[model samples]
Target: MQQIEFQLEHEFVELNQLLKLVGLCDSGGAGKALVATGEVCVDGTQELRKTAKIRAGQRVRMGDVEIQVGSST
Candidate 1:
């Protein structure tokens, strides 16, 4: 699996934006569409919320990609 580290600049980031920020998709809109396909997972469970609040210390996975969210500080 591919691992990606994302440092949060705020308390949290929207799931779709996070995917975009990490280069998973072209834009947030595309991210939302990807999430709607039920391919995204949060902490090992399927996550369908396109705008779900993703906080630090959380893990997001889609296919072979896994994004590990961390605190900015």
Candidate 2:
């Protein structure tokens, strides 16, 4: 599996924002659509909430990309 690591500026990152930050979605709107369609999985569970509160150390997967969320500091 391809592993991609990224940091959330704040303690948490919204599902849409995380998608954009990790280059999964081109824009917020696109991310929203993806999340709404139940294409996002958090820790291997399907997540349908567009604004799901993702915290540090969490893993987010959409399609073929997987990102590991961490703190910037």
Highest TM-score: which candidate?
1
Please give the RMSD of candidate 1 to the true structure. Answer: 0.4
Candidate 2: segments with Cα more than 4 A from true spot: none
**Tens digit per residue, CA lDDT, model 2, 2-56:** 6899887787888898888788779989989999988789999999989899998
Q: What is the lDDT of residue 26 in candidate 2?
A: 98
Model 1: residues with Cα > 4 Å off, grouped in runs? none
- How many residue pairs clash per model? 0, 0
Model 1, span 1-73: residue lDDT tens:
9999999989999999999999999999999999999999999999999999999999999999999999987
What is the C-alpha local distance difference test score of candidate 1?
Answer: 0.98
Instruction: Give the range of the ten consecutive residues with the poorest summed lDDT in model 1.
Output: 64-73
